[model samples]
Target: MRPQQVIDGDFTYWLGDMYALLGEKETALRWLRRTDEISNHNYPWFERDKNWNNLRSDSEYQRILADFQRHWERYREEFGDG
Candidate 1:
């Protein structure tokens, strides 16, 4: 079960990133959003990944970034850094 969770998140993230690099914005966003839903960690890489540079100026991309940040804030509230 744990392995499946890891596999799902990691594989989905790769698919999303690949689609983004291939210029498939809509499909990339769909997979990327699922990566977030299942993994919840790839958001930090959004701004730093050169592969995503092409998506930087997209309105939907920005909205996704904001949504990821809000998700992070909620996570922090629920689980302190410790």
Candidate 2:
């Protein structure tokens, strides 16, 4: 099932979050990577999202988040939202 209103590429992020909530770290990360490739979201809420708390200690997750943070920061600087 899916929500009635969703922006492009959020489906992948939802899949990743679902997997993370289920304790499927690897699968979650895989979907997240795909989301990153597909949407490259600004990620204003990503770092603080509790959905990925399970991955907080994972190195790969950290790396991905770091990359997202860099990109998101740039996005904010360019767009003036943040």
Candidate 3:
């Protein structure tokens, strides 16, 4: 029997980065948004990731930063700053 597939948010996020690297911004954003939703905005890979460097100048990238800040605030409220 074949094992069931588990679509991880992290994996999707990485796929998004790959899409971005390949110059598919819309598709990359789509996947990245899904990743963010699945992770509830707490995806750890975003903390110090370098792959997103290509998107640094995009408005969407700024929005992602804002999302990250919001996630950090929520985390602090829920678990206290670590």
Best by lDDT: 2
Q: Write candidate 2's Cα lDDT for 1-82 as tens digits.
A: 3322334467878888999999999888887777677665647677888999989999999888887888888877898773
What is the alpha-carbon lDDT of model 1 when measured against the actual structure? 0.74
Q: Per-residue CA lDDT of candidate 3, range 1-82, in tens?
A: 1112325776777787888888888777777776666654653557556777777788886687678668868888999867
Model 2, C-alpha of 33: deviation from truth (Å): 0.4
What is every candidate's alpha-carbon RMSD to the true fold?
4.5, 4.4, 4.8
lDDT of 3 at 27: 73
Show pairs that collide, candidate 1. none
Which 10-residue span in candidate 1 carries the lowest summed lDDT?
A: 1-10
Give one digit per residue, the lDDT tens place, for model 1 in 1-75. 122345487777678789899999988887767767775664566658788789989898888778777777777
